[model samples]
Target: MPYVSMSALLAFVLVYGLGLGPIPFFIASEMFEVAPRPAGMAWGSLANWGGNFLVGMGFPTMRNVIGPYSFLLFSAFTMGLFLFTKFYFPETRGKTPTQVAQLCSRGLRSRPLTTATAKHIL
Candidate 1:
């Protein structure tokens, strides 16, 4: 049980440090045009921290209700986030915020960002 807890802690740190952490802020600043970006980021930051608070505060009660099945719920939530990022989030790398906004406006099936079409986002 100690080994299992240690492994889970390490995994969380690795995953969050490598990917999950900072991504919301990065995306928030990258997704909107310059004019609205500050507002967008402020809102995004609020939502991001709000989400963390919800999960942190709710998990104990959630665990009490569902027991170990809480892990399954989180697994599904993580999968859904993965799918959303893979399919829907605008490709911000090498593309300007305006371009990203344009792509986002085009909906979920937007074209890939290429070097030829890309510009510095920040």
Candidate 2:
């Protein structure tokens, strides 16, 4: 197989293999406490579909504007977003539902975790 095809295949495998299923699970698990159960699930599903639709529908335009590496550019942006969220977003694992909601409403500064402090916890 050609290098491009192999690279593409590898990218697909890496994305779907590791990323496809885990993100929603992680987000849902975390957000469930911050939002009501029903709202959390609804928002999670909406965000998932919205993001997928936006990326799929915008691909052609993105490609045209950004050229052949549009997917790579998107991936980079996504990675940055994920990292930013991971570092800045609070970990709600053991917190009560009310506490989580309060944290969300008030942002990280009002709670225990912030980007600067996340490194210590994680």
Candidate 3:
């Protein structure tokens, strides 16, 4: 297997640090109602920490077994998420929480899965 250089690792970390790391927290906070926002944020934080722990614990074994190809698993998952968000996620800009929720519900119910109603989330 080919060795991945430190530059590639740095690039991944940089990209994640720039956008992926902070944006989810903002999005999670924006996504919930005032009444449930605290609980939602807590759950989101838990999931984030849990996922981090899983990767921290499992990455060594996965890397040892799969070598550089271990990165491919994450790349594929990230790509899927990108596509899902691009298509299914809504535009919440300038909207109230209730409006956002209603928009999401309408999109889910009336629109075809293949069609993206939201202009862009990213």
**Candidate with maximal lDDT:** 1
Write model 3 residue lDDT over 2-38, tens digit each, in one string: 3466777788789877976666677677777788788
Model 3, position 116, has a per-residue lDDT of 44
What is the TM-score ranking, best to worst? 3, 1, 2
lDDT of 1: 0.80
The runs of at least 3 residues in candidate 3 whose Cα sits more than 4 Å from the true structure, single-residue gaps closed, are 1-15, 104-122
Shift of residue 106 alpha carbon in model 3, Å:
5.5
Cα-based TM-score, every candidate: 0.68, 0.61, 0.70
Tens digit per residue, CA lDDT, model 2, 1-120: 699999997898687758764566566656556436767777777887787788779888988998987879867887887766766677787887677666667765434466767766
Error of 1 at 55 (Å): 0.9
Best by TM-score: 3
Better of 2 and 3 by TM-score: 3
Worst 10 residues of 1 by lDDT: 113-122
lDDT of 1 by residue, 1-122 (tens): 99999999899879877877777778778877889888988887888789889989999999999998898988899888876686567667888767898987777774466565455321
Q: After superposition, how far is residue 120 of candidate 1 from its true place, in Å?
A: 27
Model 2 Cα shift for residue 40 (angstroms): 1.1
Query: lDDT of model 1 at residue 49?
Result: 86
> Candidates sorted by lDDT, descending order?
1, 3, 2
